[model samples]
Target: MTTTETPGADTVRPRWGAERIGNAIFAAVVFGLGVFALVGAFAIRVPAGQAIGPQVFPFAVAVILLGSGAALVISALRGQVAPREEGEDIDPDAKTDWWTILKLVALLVAVLLLLELLGWWMVAALLFGGVAWTLGAKRPWVAFLVGLVIGIGTQLLFGEGLGLFLPRGAAFDWWYGPGPLFG
Candidate 1:
């Protein structure tokens, strides 16, 4: 018999039981939701004179989710744990860089504040630039331009063309005449 020696072999150990238990619990919760959805589909009445109602689609989705969740639970019970190719124990409370989160939150807040003052185009542009910069973007001006295009483009297409009443900001009044649009 031949044995191969590996450097730093003493540090490697199998994952703890808690991770497996946590995963099992998550699987169980998903399974329970699936069951709930499946049951809910039958609890509601289908409207008369409708060939395909809401109940049918929800029921089909629920059944599919139920089957998949059941399969996952069964696989977990059969000792088929998720493979940890990286050899690191999955810790839920692990530290992640919060800069992106802060940036996104700031963006949301800025958007809300600037919506009435600067309008969707300017607000979205500012938010996108800020977020991109915070997330290590090298060119924030590009992000700003992209954000402006996307924000105003959506409004023009959905709100103006399709006649959807998306919320407009005070800047809309300043840029164009009264009553919500440029047309």
Candidate 2:
């Protein structure tokens, strides 16, 4: 097979470039995600005799995503792609920090794995501390302490104040009767 290269074609037809195709594909993915969110939003159960429920926020977010996705899709199809961001602090030629990304991903996986066993607060603290330490925190112990405080505070705020209880510790729950650990 022989591929012919048309000289000056790229300069003449900038609209049909690789960036345009990538933008369109990204927009399509966003639109698909919006559709998924909309379906999930509709699946949420509303309490009987209540006007507004938890579904309201999801529905609103779904609508926003859908609209934005649609707009992006149209813009991309018309070759009106967004301009590349070039911040003063950013190095254009800098290589991606894959090591940092890998560490973050590993930490997230650990959080997911330990969420039920260690409980939300403990896992949250671990995640925060891990991220802080990964990002060059001088005092990792202090970071862990702060993460613990934040984790416990969120647990209290959501579980006690808002009545949205997180799992207390699945293993502990099985052993110590399903009562909440903190209230």
TM-score list, all predictions? 0.50, 0.73
Cα-based RMSD of the predictions, in order? 9.0, 7.8
Worst 10 contiguous positions by lDDT, candidate 1: 7-16
- CA-RMSD of model 1: 9.0
TM-score of 2: 0.73
96-171 per-residue lDDT for model 2 (tens digits): 7999999999999998888878887888889899999999999988888888999889888988788876866665
Best candidate (score: TM-score): 2
lDDT of each: 0.75, 0.83
Clashes of each: 0, 0
Residue 120's lDDT within candidate 2 is 78
Cα lDDT of model 1 by residue, 1-183, tens digit: 999889756554435476567667877887888889989998978769989866987788888888878888886675556764453676656666787787789788878877777766677678877888888898888998998888789778877998755566665675586665723
